[model samples]
Target chain A: MKRIKSKTAIVAIVFSLAGPLSAGESLPIRNCTWCHGSSAQGFSTAPRLAGQREKYIENQLLSFSAHIRDNPLSQQYMWGATANLSPEAMRDFAAYFSSLPPKAANDGDPQLAAQGRAIYELGIAEANVAACLVCHGPNAEGIREIPRLGGLSHAYLKRRLEQWGQGFHAAAEPMPQITRALSPNEIDALASYLSFVAYESLE
Target chain B: MKVIGLRLALPAAVLALVLSAPSRADEMGGPGFSSQELRAKLDYCKTCHGLSGQGYRGYFPMPRLAGQQPKYLENQLRAFYERRRSNPVMANVAHALSPSMVAALAAHFKDLNTNPIGGAPKEPVALGKTIYELGLPEANIPACSACHGPEAKGQGEIPRLAGQLFPYTVKTLGNWSKERGQGPAKDDTSFIMAATTHNLTQAQVAAIAAYVGSLR
Candidate 1:
């Protein structure tokens, strides 16, 4: 009888521990966590969905559905992930992921941070580059539809910036125009600087 | 000795010519930006100010410069340069612009007639229209139309309020005393709206902003 009681307790403990993951099983969030980190912090190719702007994530999901955000990685992974995703599902997923706490990638050259900060704050006016802070916020904490740029991975940020310059997300106005103004060195600096930024909470 | 002197003279002359070449646009023509230079500067302005100078909602609301009065534009630019307007971004931007460049930019933006990027809450629009047209006499506020013109297209140093961003107008009027009239030594036209801004309630200000912001 004591052995039977211990088995039931163990089963209860397992179920309790598995609650969050099982919740995703019903919501298809498991598919996302497969590419994105288990905690939605992001993995190799996928970006951190945690602490992202819900609106921005929704917009990107819609963009992916429409094939508007045609970057190579986006085309490969996100396109399939977001395809046929219902509006309700999109909203739920965006809300869930964005609510999660984010961790900084912290994978950038430390030396280039200052130069990146300068460009992000003031922009290279001679090059007609607008300040990134004007839209991205003081600490790169975005508001409303603007995605939170702080703590995004260096590789992801750099690629997005480069892709914009290369004419991938043409419909994402101001970014394409803005990125066109950024030089290669400036892009590298900005990516490096943004990668190291750690935020305590969601914007 | 003659050959060495000739070589040195040639290189020195070349260096002098290169060094003396006009580095800035204003240097090319006495106190004026050349056409190419003006075009480049306009592009810079548009990067933040919108392609048509219609203004944009960035981290901060970039005000609508399109169809703005040239005098107002020039004054604001000078205000930024002089620290009367305490905006770090605009201060740096304005410092780079010379008098002629300012003039050229002002003229360029004044000619633009883009549609408003309307995204204000429409529920209070009617109340806003009323406040804009008929001021609260009890509160000692004059009808905005009286000075801003019936259409809110301001004259001279007064700014054009039509199609201005709702948030920008609200912020400007709400923080009028703080942001503008900062230079006690140099009181400018921003004082014209000081009493009105002070008298208007937050709701009233929002209404007025919403009304004028949606106009053309």
Candidate 2:
């Protein structure tokens, strides 16, 4: 896996140098694909960009550029990456990434999935947690500006949920409030359930 | 020994009275929820319905409850619980709420006043205003103002349309029959809308939605 990652990084670097001449697109795909993985399926800390809602991706890019999405990792990497990008370039990137087919991360604890599904669908009314499906969709295939939550990596999902609770991304409305209602255990369950969800199951 | 027994009896009677007071208050139509519970539930509701009950646009548009008629809100909550309304999300939400909680929530939303989260097109507003004030006689449409009031502030079981989300109103009006009055028993209030919702053309629906959505 380490060897393959290094090879991917080398190829990404090569492509970054030769990309503009061959593709005619000024925005370098390597800039995102470097950490997001060759297929944009997400590596380690970086989230999967593939099959994300176009508007959501665009909005996030704008947020990152404005430094509104101030999570540690975002500030460390995405802030500089999006700083120089124009609106058209952001839209193009969003369109390109959103068109790619997504694959489920499938790297979460299977035992917790049922509990997560319950939280996702019905919510814990006693705890005052709102049903995620109300806005995220039944299958978690988000619409318009809502980010698709299905098939994301457990680590990425968990970190993001935790960050919202920690008050990192204050600009994302309702998320901080929503995550505040979630306990550490609930977050684990949610992240686990979402990781194994395949987008094709919607059919 | 007699004095000690009498003192014990007095204390026991006071304890019983204190314990019974909450149930008695519930029987008298007071809110079953504590202030904290009510606040938490309201926050849960605002998570999708907008922080100020101005409504929100999500995967499905959550309707504005701000300044809505308490009677209408209560009836809708009942409809959801009874399966008269076909919304699965609302059904689950309504199922969790007791009658007193429903009443309390409705009353809370009834007092909220917020501006519309405007996104409707400006072009068809004139046509919308015309239809709102004076219905198309040829189409058998009565003026919305006739029932919803000139200011669009509804009374009793009639819902207030002022400051409602444009997309939400459009979707609700468009799929009224499909979403509402789904139970074995008939819903009288929803029945009145059956004809009105059916008669309006797509363009007319957009116009009316745009107009009411812009109302303060």
* Model 1 lDDT per residue over A1-203, tens place: 97577557545644554666553354667788888987788888789998898988888899999888888898888888888899888988887777666788888788999999998888877667788999889888887789888888998899999987666777676687688778888899999999888886433
Q: Chain B of model 2: TM-score?
A: 0.85
lDDT of each: 0.80, 0.84
Per-residue lDDT of candidate 2, residues B23-49 (tens digit)? 543443455767557556777888899
Q: How many backbone clashes does candidate 2 have?
A: 0
Candidate 1's DockQ? 0.23
Compared with the true structure, what per-residue lDDT tens digits does model 2 show for residues A70-89? 88999999999999999999
